[model samples]
Target: MNSSAIAAGPVFSARDITRVYRMGEVSVHALRGVTMDLYRGEFVVLLGPSGSGKSTLLNILGGLDVPTTGSVHFLDQNLTQSTDRELTQFRRDHVGFVFQFYNLIPSLTARENVALVTEIANNPMDPAEALALVGLEARVDHFPAQMSGGEQQRVAIARAVAKRPDVLLCDEPTGALDAKTGIVVLEVIERINRELGTTTAVITHNAMIAEMADRVISLSDGRVSEIRRNERKRPASEIVW
Candidate 1:
């Protein structure tokens, strides 16, 4: 971990971010003034319960949604107010996302599934190289049905990292796996961040997973509850979750 101070400010900056949904008339506040900075090459873990704004925050950060009131800046670009076209380009060009589900196309081979993404990216690595990064070179042509959960997840990671994105947003990426399998998936993610220097943010309820991050931010009731810098982060295998 050895969290260095957020250098040169933040690569991704959120300020007093708030998101409210209106049904009929009354508002349901999903994000109640959550603010944070994600520095480049930083591994950040966000911990929170359901309905605690974790996913909402991630969505906003990933350009899938916008804040009800607040600001988000990616590098010097104002993501909060970016036009739809601009945001779409930003997402395609600079962000890579992984979710709880593998989301692989059942009919597509692992390499093809990954290629579906990289083909549209500006400067992507070959799908083969991406799969190799996740230790899936041998399974390149395997379909989702032919892969184990961990292996499928590695394919998802391969798809994400092939684009050389500036930021990687993962939402409960290992939520469905057993502890042992989850660690393997987490290890792949950690390795990608280390090797590519991607600014990574992972949202998970598993508290022990925080030990694998450079900084841990806990959310509660739509707000940031605590932020701690890990003095030293152990490898995923050393984590006791």
Candidate 2:
């Protein structure tokens, strides 16, 4: 991490970032000169249509991918300038990600799956404690194969938070589940954000979830189309479907 480079301010400061993908003679521009500031302990919801560059922005923020132009400064580390190893280490130390699919190992029990991450974390929480945080204490011994979609997603959240990361990046975490199942998963995520203060950013197509967030950022055509601040965020359970 570069100490002198990171300014004393927001957790993330992205300045005019652009991501371009080439397919032979054709090129795709995902993010076009997008700039933003993401604060710590903030629950932000990103809403956008398909191919609107929302996921691309989240990927850059998570250090899963780099921008072709501009910079992303995370807690003083220039994410766009790090090597593969540095990026990997940075992700291990500073970030946690939850996606649409619950990627729990089928052979491992819930506890063991979560334990896999804790073992590598610098100062990880106990696997059991993480599971308990997501209301899965009794089902810790169950395998991924035995759990429902919602339960599996809860396990994913537990695994992500076990590391006590500074950032939690979720991309359509409830996309694969039904309405009821998705709400349950959302509740778990909200609870984790409130309890752990994990500075969460959740990107989703379901605009209803925006009610539970501290702010909403809407993206269109690779730019921040709108940013709305909520005076008061309702509880996850109270969020209207």
Candidate 3:
């Protein structure tokens, strides 16, 4: 964690949160007494195995889900108390999400795919500029099917960031790519965090990727097992699978 970001206080404060899914006779606890804070302009990695609740926590933070118990406050707003419509607006205005899949439109070109978000966003970047930020300047006219996996993922990243969101949440962003391509994606994420100062949280099962984060948050069985801050963060370019 950057000391400066810590000084700025938390952008997100989640307290004593619990999420339960009821399915007929069974109840699944996706998050159990989870409490965490995401600071402004910091890069955090959510490290965990499957069923560890990292994705659940990310979803809650992104306003896609609400906790069954406890509170989530984003700056002055109480997310847990927000209505579905309010949450929808919050997501629209503030949050950006990238997942394992590219989630790009098949018929749309790279610039067109990113333009979708920019069109709905307030004070968004030009789609071409956003694509250039992800090193896809020359490929803006290419369709998702025409680009490589890494390039497609970069388009997804560009779309997510074009709105100039305060926070970026990515779940297994590099899961679909090979090591070389994954590193390229990681580099793009790192650049965004450094340049745009977006508070970023990425979910990954790969421990090696944790080295690039300012802080690594480990989850186990629906709880935060540990939180470790790196004294000196490693560059994504130096990381290997």
Candidate 4:
């Protein structure tokens, strides 16, 4: 990739964002003041310990939550100023999110779970095609209860990407899986980013996962502590830990 392309303005820009929770007499500052950019088609790893505000920031970026102060822009649109209905539309049309839990409906088969999204999306891939992207084509007929943790997670991923959103935001996507399974999950994510060119951000507590990111952003006490570029990005299969 050219340096100029990498330096091009970000797809998502956040400035002076803050989030605070008031617990009666106590005030919890989840994000002090976070400013960052997520470049187009780049895979970013958000590396932080628990309570570091990585997930909070991801939620803000994805329009699931808003900051107490400052502004966030996705492309030319200001998310901070968008109405609830507008935000909902924005999320439905532009963003895809995968959480730590599979959240697949127990009664639905893998293909049906993915079809639930594709059916609503404006321009969606076939449910089976989405499953194939995640290496789950053979398991499309299996229900959530019949699949392993990793397989279920892949189904969740398939559901998220079936709509072909511009960005993919994943919060602790591999948190519930074993080492081998987590790597397999990560490989799927990595493949999606590479092949589809979907800008992706992954929140992870394990620093070893940084090797696969185009850039690594580290958070400390709700603030960005460091941002580094990985000159030689490794495939997720080679990441240990």
Candidate 5:
């Protein structure tokens, strides 16, 4: 890995971001002055225990949520200053997200699920190509009900990336699967980041997954505790549970 390449300004930069949730009389602080940068074409793993604010930060980066303070700049665009409509367009245009659960429609086949996003994208890949990228070409005609948990999740991943978004934000992507199955899903994600050069960020509690990331960011109590760069990144298949 080239230090100069990593030092080049990040594709996504967050500065002193904070998120507070008000619950009736009490206010819950999810993120306290969190600052970070995600460089272009790098796979980053966000490691944290529950309530560590990893997901909140991911959501804010994906434009699904906003911070209470500070600013987020995706490339040169200031996301914090964008209106709701602009944020919506930003998400559709530049971001792709995958969650722990495979939120595929039961009635839709894998191809149709991916087509849902390609239909609206500006310069989208073909639905079949997207499914192929995730190694799901053979399962394109299968409905979500007919597929295994990992397969359905792959379909979800395909749908997310069909639009060829610059960034892929995954929140606990492998959280619901068994170890072996999770590795399979992780491999697909790794392949996408490698082959498509998508700037990927995955949130996970599993420390083993950090081995596959170019950089591992650990969060504690709504703050970034540490960030470590991997000298030799390991393949996801080599990650032991």
Candidate 6:
């Protein structure tokens, strides 16, 4: 953890958390006694392979899923004990999620796509402001089909951040783009984390991306294998596949 982050305390504290999925007669453990903390304004990367439970843990932290055992605290609120409605409210009020694929509506322009989130948020950035923040001011009127994959992904990012959520949870945010374009998307995310001071956690299989994080947490076979803090974090522009 960063020293500053430690002094501020954690925005999220998860303890002995585990998730078990039952498929017919068999049980699959997605998380095994995962304990972690995400501090305000710090960038952390969850590094893992497929089925390593990074995504599951991210979802749990974002209130998309609850663990079968243990507890998760987002500030003073216990997410594990929240009802479905409370979890929904929790996600709406505090979390911003960016997935691998851009989930923009095809018919909506970039500004309109971002407006969908701002409309429901308690407090939000103007859609145009959010688009500008992601370097998409010129593309605000462009529809999904008019944009490249990277551009569309930026629009997705714009939408997620429009609500000015407390935390930005990204899952393989650049997995679908080429190295050059992926670097661009990462630059946007990095800028947001720095400028907005939104607690950010990104999940990736690419080890090179970990260099940009304040901490790198390695996960394997549903368990956290290692956690290391970066003494000198690199900028996203210097990262490559």
**Which of candidates 1 and 6 reaches a greater lDDT?**
6
lDDT of 4 by residue, 1-241 (tens): 3466458888899999999988999989999999999888999999999999999999999999999999999999999999999899999999999999989999999999999999899999999999999999899999999999999999999998999999999999999999899999999999999999899999999999988999999999999999999999999999888
Clashing pairs in 2: 6-76
Local error of candidate 6 at residue 52 (angstroms): 0.3
**Candidate 4 segments whose C-alpha is farther than 4 A from its true place:** 1-4
After superposing all C-alphas onto the true structure, candidate 1 shows an RMSD in angstroms of: 1.4
What TM-score, to 2 decimals, does candidate 4 have? 0.98
Q: What TM-score does each of the candidates earn?
A: 0.96, 0.95, 0.98, 0.98, 0.98, 0.98
lDDT of 4: 0.94
Query: Candidate 3 on 87-164: residue-level lDDT in tens?
Result: 999999989999999999999999999999999999999999999999999999999999999999999999999999
Candidate 5 local Cα displacement, residue 139, angstroms? 0.8
On residues 118-223, what C-alpha lDDT tens digit does candidate 5 reach at each position?
9999999999999999898899999999999999989999999999999999999999999999999999999999999899999999999999999999999999
* Candidate 3 local lDDT, residue 176: 99
Model 2 residue 212 CA deviation in Å: 1.0
Expressed as tens digits, the lDDT of each residue in 1-241 for candidate 1 is 2245364678888999999999998999999998899998999999999899999999999999999999999988999889999999999999999999989999999999999998899989999999999999999999999999999999999999999999999999999898999999999999999989998999999899999899999999999999998888978998776
After superposition, the stretches of candidate 1 with alpha carbons farther than 4 Å from their true spots are 1-5
Off by over 4 Å in 2: 1-8
Against the reference, the lDDT scores of all candidates come to 0.93, 0.89, 0.95, 0.94, 0.94, 0.94
| Clashes per candidate, residues 3 or more apart or on different chains | 1, 1, 0, 0, 0, 0
Q: What is the C-alpha RMSD of each candidate to the true structure, in Å?
A: 1.4, 3.6, 0.8, 1.0, 1.0, 0.9
* Model 1 pairs whose backbones collide: 1-233
lDDT of 6 by residue, 127-216 (tens): 999999999999999999999999999999899999999999999999999999999999999999999998999999999999999999
lDDT (C-alpha) at residue 65 in model 1: 98
Model 3 reaches what TM-score against the true structure? 0.98
> Over the stretch 1-241, how does candidate 2's per-residue lDDT look in tens digits?
1223224478988999999999999999998889887887888999888898989999999999999999999988999989989999999998999988988999999999999999999999999999999899999999998999999999999999999999999999989988888888889989888878788999987788888888898999899999898878877777655
Better of 1 and 4 by lDDT: 4
Worst 10 residues of 5 by lDDT: 1-10
> What is candidate 1's CA lDDT for residue 232?
85
